[model samples]
Target: MDGTLLTPPKRSARARGAVLGALMLGAFTFNTAENLPIGLLDVVAGRLGVSVPATGLLVTGYGLTVAVASLPLTHAVRSVPRRHVLTGVFAALAVSSLAAALLSSYGPLLAARLVTALAQALFWAVMGPVAVGLFPPGVRGRVIGALSVAGSLALVAGVPGGTWLGRHGGWPLPVTVAAVLGLVSLVTVAVLLPTTRPEAEPAALGISPDRRRFALVLTAGALSATGAFAGFTYLVPFLGDVGGFRPETIGVLLVAFGLACLAGVSLAGALLDRSPHGVLTGAVAVQATGLLGLYAWGARPAAAVLFLVLTGGALGPVFMATQHAMLHCAPGRTDLAFAANSGAYNVGIAAGAALGGLILPYAGVRAAFLAGGLLAVAACAVLLPGRPRPAES
Candidate 1:
């Protein structure tokens, strides 16, 4: 038997559910920590005696750390049991969150966030393979989608809730809550999850062995994400400038978008395993259509929100499907492949924002949406031509 296949312990339904719950909780905790600064930016800046623009670096710095460190850190812990590595990462995140809350000073807080960023980068890199190992292959798409739901929930509830709490209770309150949740997740994982080892199997039954094909998947993902972010990053301004939405209305719209994202992932969970390529193709088309709609009809308030919903719904599933595709295509090196995916995602985000900024100066915000639409169309072109053959074991 190859080292790639490990038989997971046959556990009861309740036990399996507990394990999945713990993993999801861990996902929620880390995602909340990553986005907490977005909520506390003004408060943190005021308390730390810095400009709000300077505090924005907190988000950028964390993204850079995750993008740079994901592959190397995952490689470093390649030989460790996934259970142990995850537990350690959660513990570190908890500690870092607590430190950031207590220190409150800008420099110390930034340092603490960077610490958590390292853990987050590594966590995302390995979580896909870990989820696959714990569940049956037939339900892989569902498991991955469920896990991705945690992230969507974080965006929908965590950030807004944290901001509200910070506004009422104080900035430190949110970080402290995140730290406590991280600890709870750490305890849950340590107690509930079984120790699992990596399989030495060549690859999964339907995966492709061609490295170039794997690279294509990554490229497509990057393009799709770039297209999404180009308009998404400037959505608030677009709504205000074009649609004439008030501040409160825009906040409601953001929540609506998040809910659409949740719905999107739920649907993808059911369909992805049966037809990975088809799902990707459909998602890309939907995203392109939504963006183009926004470009053409954004001046109308109702149409703008409608297209926003469409875009969010399609955009939400792309992450999970892409991750599933990567893990499926390279089951033998799931961690490494996912690390690359994580990096690609971050790069796409940065690139899309940069491109949008350039377009914003020369063209109006609507033109940026058109640019994003073109990129999404290009992404679809890349994936529609070839079917990735299932690799031989």
Candidate 2:
């Protein structure tokens, strides 16, 4: 037998759990590294003697690379063992992070960031199918939910912690730790992931697939992301100007919002398998309600906090459910479809931020939340009425 799985399901529950944990660690590390620059833009800029805007390119550029390269790279390695491919990617990410730390110049570090982005492209493409493959199909929703939780942790723990370290110790310290974390994930996955024959049917491919439903899933995903980020990108400005929150208290609020995100994904994992589309529609509705409520009531501090947390709660599930739904609804190859979804999500992030920026100059920050709320509502519209439900794969 091929080695994609190391043991029979009945015997390897613990082993499967351990491997899933390693995958979770890798997912956390990759997501953290991708967004870490945002929190440390100024710190990184000062260390490299560049402007903060220039340092911000590290993030925007990385997203561009991943969005462009995800499908091609995922296709190229279609025949490789996932265990091998993922471990290689982790090794590459580790090297790139180390390169960023060692190189002082902006040009060199930017090159390193691109390498990390390339690795991340393929990592996202495979990680989902791989995670679900470890468990029985009945639990796929829960599997995605668990993975999304690790990703959410990156926002609350990894990004914030890196920012704190950079502010105190230096930028390179967090960058180096990023490398260390990548290496740790690399070793763990290499040891635990099962070996496999290259010719074996991929565990990650869609079983009961649908192109129309898949298109609907992608549309809903991109729209929801666009809506959420439009508001999220301007959270601080909205809080400061509308909610009258102080800088110190905003951090606490953010931490609370992050915790709410954790709760969202956890609930999604519990309920997604039971009714996938229903959860998707409901999450988007909840997100829209929060944004709309924020736009209408954010002038009051207590109401602002409540709606902000409500939106935060839905944000994690909105996108998490998108990818989970994709696992069953992929139009073609699951990995390739995943690549497309990742690209769309990244595009959504860029679009939402750009749109919010444009709105801020003309309509004000409150208008941005209103715009976001409308888009999320539109996402709900995309998921319901005539949309065909996909069969569980």
Candidate 3:
């Protein structure tokens, strides 16, 4: 595991820190690009002279692209060095962001977004395994959690900041900033990250390699994600329409929701190694409770906010636990397994939003919460049959 021409050499503490920072920043930047359109929807639509709904497809299209491409691209890169491959991913993100910034037409902008999505496909599939490879196996949970935190910040900080830029400067300004962030991450990673060997260490492979357990992880994670985003996608409108909160208060509430997510991921990080199954079980249940609660009591602003935070809190940990389980129970190549998990997750995101959209007109936005809650509860049932065995080393 020590120095080789291809594999990671002995890493200094500082080098490892730099490497992780690069990866985390890469994650943050990619996610910001992915979600930035949500904040810039109206602005982008107006500038592009398109319908708001058409402009919103940037997010949906991006998720679908990642979902469809992750496995194939991960397979395609199987023979390549991960560090070098990841550099390409970052480079693509930069190029795609710049294209988004420059494109005058909606069709071209969508194309640019999808290009970034393709890079993200490869990025998510590789990042977890690569980060796990760098550290001692004992702290893998924390590592994954930290990485998820970087992503969650895309919701709290990155999107809002981009929104500010888009509002003040133009839609392209935030997209351009994302391009710069991607370039910075690309350079930092290229310079600092130690090269990893092509062959995985036994420690790096799944401990159990159970197809059934791995399926459960993906199924449960996807279900909960579907449910969470169902309400989450429409949450702002729900708050305004149902909860009667002012615009300024809703912004504050969003920050609280984001903080709650961080709290959940941090707690899961501490507990995941000890109880991966338990952590997942608890998170899905909390997810169900939050969504169901929202459906039942969302008319009351206090209860609505409380359940919203609860939903936010459980959301990050659910995916964290899913990735952790995938690492432990993958039936084949760990990277491929991670790729599948990432694909499944994006499928959930796209499905949840679409489902919410379908249900919103017919059943009303509150019904989305019910559908999501039921899905999370079903996820809980999925976990009951059997779970991944913890490593006994």
Candidate 4:
């Protein structure tokens, strides 16, 4: 009945699964690239001859670029074939990582990171839709769930692995490994991903239908992230100064925390689609409690590690809940909502690091946890009234 249907056999399930695996690897590679620096901040700063706080500006700047560029870059690439766009992003990231490895000075390294941030922004914006489109509707949820697992595993593997490599091999080793992963991801995508033309008009920036809900969701996201990252970005310092962890021991602890994060993601995925608001509120409450515990007992090694695990566990779920909330609240504007959410997330990252940097010298590391807990409480307050609306009668 249709020439197109008969033109060629569809890809086999095995082939499709391999493509999906490649996409997941892309997710893993990109996340690893972004998070690699987190574990190597001190090493990077020391090697580049900059103060640690000034080194923090690298994280701050990268997040700011992603927040600023996500929407626009996504719009620019909306009409491009998904395969080419994804492949290009991976290639760019590979090059950026290589530049970061080779650059001698802090300025050039920072510049290279900024370029990577641009590619990362577009990658996050488009990755979901492309992944979902590759599968039938009936299997989409599974595909996304698997992709999320890949992302969580990136944390499981990337951060600690990078830290270990950096400790033994030097700062460049971790980033260089990230570069290799990026290249592998690039080739996988190019060879495996089928070209898919845009199915609808590109998502654009516009006023959300429910302004109050949108504002609340955005604020909640920003506040929660600020709370988490304030302490998280400085976690290595906290572990050394407060928890009394040796450099090698810190890597093991980070891996433990990453495992908790994976569990949190799994739990959130199970719960969020049912009640986004409840899950978000509960996550914030738990996180706040954990941060407060860390603040009070961080001087004790066991207590600090316990609280760290709890805090890490809650982080993933909060992100999942925020994404779920944004999608549910915005009726026809999922794209705009996602973009706003992404921006809020990164803005919170910058804000948290800046806030922690300011406070670390003045008040102390414990105070950072206290401040972060208060921010989480603030997020809870904003989200209290933001239960998803009842279905239309």
lDDT of 2 at 195: 71
lDDT at 98 for candidate 1?
89
In candidate 4, stretches whose alpha carbon ends up further than 4 angstroms from where it belongs are 1-12, 41-57, 135-145, 167-173, 197-211, 237-251, 299-302, 331-333, 390-393
Instruction: After superposing candidate 3 on the true structure, give the runs of residues whose Cα lies further than 4 Å from its correct spot.
Output: 1-9, 201-204
C-alpha positional error of residue 20 in candidate 3 after TM-score superposition, expressed in Å: 0.5
**Regions of model 1 farther than 4 Å from truth:** 1-6, 200-206, 390-393
Candidate 3 per-residue lDDT, tens place, 93-193, comes to 99999999999898989998999999999999888878877777777888888898898889889998999999999998999999999998899889887
Least accurate stretch of 10 residues (summed lDDT) in model 1?
198-207
In model 4, which residue pairs have backbone atoms overlapping below 3 Å?
none
The Cα error of candidate 2 at residue 179, in Å, is 1.3
Candidate 4 on 1-393: residue-level lDDT in tens?
Answer: 111111212666776677678777877777777777766788888899998878877776787899999888866766787788888998998999999988879999999999998988887776665565555533333455576677888889767678899989988888888788788878878887777554332222221245677788789889999998898878889889988889999978888888988887777666654555677889888888888888899889889888988898888777666655544454344444666677788889888988998999999988998999999999989988766565200
Residue 214 lDDT in candidate 1: 74
**Local accuracy of candidate 2 as per-residue lDDT tens digits, 49-138:** 999999999998998898889889988998898889989998999999998888999999999999999999999888887777777777
Pick by lDDT: 2 or 3, better one: 3
How many Å off is the CA of 133 in candidate 3? 0.6
Candidates' C-alpha lDDT:
0.82, 0.85, 0.86, 0.75
Worst 10 residues of 2 by lDDT: 2-11
Candidate 2 vs candidate 4: which has greater lDDT? 2
Backbone collision count in every prediction?
7, 0, 0, 0
